[model samples]
Target chain A: MIRFVLACLVACGMLGSVSVCHYMLTRSPVTEPPTSIQPTLRSESALQTPHRTPDQQADTTVSPSRIQLQNNDAARRFFLILTSGFNTAPDPFALGSDGLTEPTRLSAQYGDKSIITLLNDLLRGESIRSSEFDVADTDITRGTLTLFIRATPAETDARIPCPLRIDLIRADGFPCDTYTLWTPGNGVMLTGEATLNPVPGSNTAALGWELVK
Target chain B: MIFRNIYWIFWLHLLLNSMIPCSSARAEPLFTVVASTTQIADLAREIAGDRCRVISILGPGINPHGYMPVPNDGKTVASADLCLQNGLHLEGKNWMATLVRDNGNRPIITCSDGIIPLHLDYDGTVVDDPHAWFDPRNAAIYVNNILKGLIVMDPEGASQYTARASLYLNQLRVLDAWITEQFHQIPPEKRILVTSHDAFNYFAARFGLTVRSPVGWSTGAEIGGGMTPERRRHVVASIREGQVPAVFVETTVNPKIIEQIAQEAGVRIGGHLYSDAMGPAGSAGERYIGMMRENTLTIVEALSR
Candidate 1:
């Protein structure tokens, strides 16, 4: 009878241990907490910048009503023809500063490195000091550049704009200056010399006296 | 006995973790994604690879500027889990917006959202022109963004998408190098490139081609409004003074204007260039590389001659 009572006491102890283990397992700490970031609330000033928002300035940066210049088949054709047929000689104003003296410094803006090189070559051909020609600005909205040329009182704009001609280098690498007139009035005859020379470091140019009209 | 219990518990925990659907549920989807244009569609296909069924509505020779999506096209976009577009108002806003409205749940990824677009001169006014695909480098970013979307949709396929994207990026690198090499064939002085539309500003800027065009970039605008007679006269004068020998035509745009210009200026129409879309399957311009190679060769041959 004494042995039986001892066995019961041991059984009670074992049950107590099991209950403790169950409680420990059930109350285990979280293994994996969230790794996500907590969003911070922003102040009103933080949300609003002093500068004008794009939406607010949308009206000032209005898009052209007619965006595609190529949609007009006739106009496109004429543009191609004019590009191909027009003489591409360097504008005499591009050579001289004020139509009275040859430019000693020149700057051209064209994104294309090749066009920049071509412009440089053309300038060198005009006997403009090679050091005078440098790429002032090369990034335009498109491929066109607003170039500036400065003369150092070396040569006079002796020839009028009519006598001055610009020779253009074609995309195909051919020299183009004049083409057969396809329109009325012998299209684009130079009556007298016209000049176009930009101020130093500015896009604004002095319109050389040219009589294209 | 206590040690044995502890070991048993660890084993049971591992077993449960392995048997659960943790990996399978996270597996990404693999559907072929088709696009409307090769520029964007090609990018999507590059990102999707074996995971998606990629197809384009506008194949080689097709033009997105004037593409008329058919009934099947709407169905295709509507059913897809995700649809991709070039969205700078590229695919006429009307049709694209309608498609988006129809497929409310499906995500329509715009590839050109962050790109700096080229502005064109339209009647002395500046506007954003939406032909961003001409530059292959910009296309690389487009493909990357597509991969982002694909990964979100199918996390399991993220690795596959990444692999395919890298391969496509390598191809674009080769394309860029090839364009530079091809432009080298023409004498530096003869590298003046003029097209029927202002679609080539990006190409010209990237490849060092001097371009002149009467038309600005987008084809969605009115034809006669910006292209005034005065501009035509100026262009004619430029042609007479400039010695441009040949002009180019885009595959999708009507070549009538180019032809008229050629006739008037006595210059040859170089050839049709693939600007907006690739050729149909089994054609020379069906794939991205094929289309770009064809363009390079056309420009080279035309200008080199």
Candidate 2:
């Protein structure tokens, strides 16, 4: 009789604990939007700065910084084209045998922590590859847009120099050349819409951004 | 007797807990949006995210220009929280508008609202072009209009809609950039787009390409519009004069005209571009972006060589 009473109580206790834990875990979903790309009607300054200093960019665990321009109302859209050594990853601006743009291929060819790796990471971010947009051209121009580009150091060991040329194109259509980036703590940031020239920022040797236009 | 009842209830609680755990049963979506065309349907789906359900009255490759609502289409919109249509007379003879009107005064939103329309001379009267989604920037406007309608219907999902709209807008920007870059390969002299009708004006204007189509194309009141001898002559002249290496057939338009033009012009048929509707399911042009991507690829390959 005593054992039967204890078993019932034990069983009841276990059920209660399971319910409480489940409630706690399920109720608190990750509802907050990532801080980098929150939409708001702000001054152009927000698009102008993106953790240029190394200390400000030490944490690479979160998503790369994505700055939105002007009340999240964008009249023109832009895409970045990367001209690197990887043949499989076709330059978006170039014509190849096939009609498809080969996706980015990332190997430790530069020891995952190098600038090239960081570039690949930025290009492969969710924002770069997401397919939820069905945008059309607009005639009503929004105010001047402050371009924000964030470059963070990827965790890699290889320090080999990778020469790369980068160009920027907006949806309205145009291109520019020449670029420069200041280095801090082995991290580099590129801003502006039309062109990008990367000056070596960290330990990687011979890493340069060429004018590819 | 009371003790026996207590034991039964305890086991029942355990059984119920095992099945449901901590999550409550999910309710039906916040609301349902019914769009007249697949393109607008996709826009609503993009903005709605997982918050609500979106249904398109017409299926893939069904020309919106002359879509006649079936029996089920009426039932489909009957349960809709909101109705959407591509205004500017894309819905041949106002078929979609008439359908929505009979749906009992639902909050109908013209997805093409706020677009600075591209007007074409139709029957001696200038009318706005209906195929505005071709431009990535205009696509942004369409998405925003849909977002606003959704927000009005379900205020609580405004942030969700806005956030999604931002992501989608960014994507549009990327697409626009990519399309421009792809077109850069074609020499300026060869940057001409020849299609069955005037559906690609916004796209060509947005990018650095020129579009040439037959006269009375802007007023194509029927799908795969009947080709007149004069219109046929215009198409052949456009191809020969523009030195267009290849012309494209349309998924929704009658390909017979394009095929005859391609043969008459002595140019190879490049490929069929998705204009009035996206490709059938499982095809490259299944989604809006997919359609654009495939269309650009087709155009690039045909024109570059």
Candidate 3:
């Protein structure tokens, strides 16, 4: 009976010690500042600079150092061209032969300097290639963008129900210079009313315009 | 009977005492973590500090754009109790969509969801720009969102998370102030930014900088082939005129064109800018903070004097 009492007392003692230790470990005390390190904007500055720099006394514009302009030339007008096209349907030919008339077409006209952005309104997994149109009379300024597509002409022999999607690009062809997956945009319309036409019976279509100043 | 009861009580006491240390050791985390990359897999480590593991999937130098899914990525995503991502389509809508589609249980938090995005005026097609993290102010929003998510995920460590987040947020504010101060070194006119793509709109708008690009907002577009001869001449002229002191290249995009532009216009290619992706690890541009700091330093050095 004495031993039982002793055990109870020890157990309670252990619990009390643990509680006290936990309290000590977790306790955060707030203390009054001794006035020397008290936070104030003026006090901070006084601590930083016993002798204030003359520049801080009065707001004066420091003479800005000018860089020697090397090969200084006037700003020129740059034109950026944007084309809208997509392959909504699969190509008819699986052999993947390059044709003249591509599945889509892009054309642009701008005067001097212009910056244009072509938005590919396709989901991430979707794919599009550049060879879908003949980039006639156009030269790519930046080599960053490269596209490939096989061109096929519209057939005159029979009245096809839907325009066949020509194999604009081979399976191994580089479709876009930079693949922008998940890029979204509405259908391409120039001048607020014109919409690019889809290949007559095929799901693919083309829209072209020039962004120039 | 009393002796038997006393023996049972002693064993129980011993068992409870033995568990006390283990429970106390795990009572709270020892540190607070903030990661810039979404690819980190150590979510538990970040919020839980030393107490748990934290991982990020996209870290320094990883391109969330055009990032292909790997088998390990799936495991990381599955193992994480909470995941944070830069939404606003910055993760290449495909990446974010796929992650959400795959993880049914975990919340794929969008850090940039609440912040207003800069709209890209693509000839009147006003769309919310996804590159909000480019600006430090916007990045503050992202950090706050991460803090909220971390606290919610690990409510037990709420105090730790809050404290860490506040500390980190103060650092971010310092970074912002530093960037502004460093920018003052450059003359106002020299603040014009010409990059390979239009990825710096938010940064430009926030910092009173003018941005021009060979390409538009999305780097995935065909920007080069669309330039007309007159437009080419204009860019050539911009180089000759010295309106733009330096042109920057993007990490994921090719720099050849910008280099060529530099050659034509006689301006130097300022430096490589982290756009769709970050710099390789160990480089100054590796982490989010490092990347921003390096960019500011590079900009100040190149444009200032």
DockQ of 2: 0.05
Residues B1-305 of candidate 2 have per-residue lDDT tens digits of 66666677777888778667434556468798899988989878988987788998989988887667887887788889999998888888887778777866678888777667888764466768889899876787777778778889999999888888877765775687678778878999898888888899999987779987753443354533445788778778878988899989888887876777889988888998999888877998888899999999999999999
Evaluated at residue B183, the lDDT of candidate 3 is 75
Q: After superposition, how far is residue B154 of candidate 1 from its true place, in Å?
A: 1.4
Candidate with top DockQ is: 2
lDDT of 2 by residue, A1-213 (tens): 565576589768979887886777567676887569676555322322242334322321112221222113331344344443211232221111012223223211111222222224433223222111112222112112222332322323112223233433333333322223321222111222322211112112112333232
- Please state the error at residue B166 of candidate 3 in Å: 0.7
DockQ of each: 0.01, 0.05, 0.03
In order of appearance, the predictions have TM-scores of: 0.51, 0.58, 0.50
Residue-by-residue lDDT tens digits, candidate 1, B198-296: 778888888788777655455546321334456556555566566666678887777876677667777788888888777777878867678788988
**TM-scores (chain A) of the candidates:** 0.18, 0.27, 0.18
lDDT rank, highest first?
2, 1, 3
Residue B119 lDDT (model 1): 76
Q: Compared with the true structure, what per-residue lDDT tens digits does model 3 show for residues A1-213?
A: 777778778877877786677676657786877667664333212222112244331211112220111111111112122322333321112111012112222222222311121232322123333222322111211111122222111222111221212122212221211111111111111121111111111111121112121
| Angstrom error at residue B259, model 1 | 0.7
Q: Sorted by DockQ, highest first, which candidate order results?
A: 2, 3, 1
Clash counts for the predictions, in order = 63, 18, 43
Residues A128-206, candidate 1: write the lDDT tens digits.
1111122222111121222222111111221212122222222222221211111111111122211111111111111
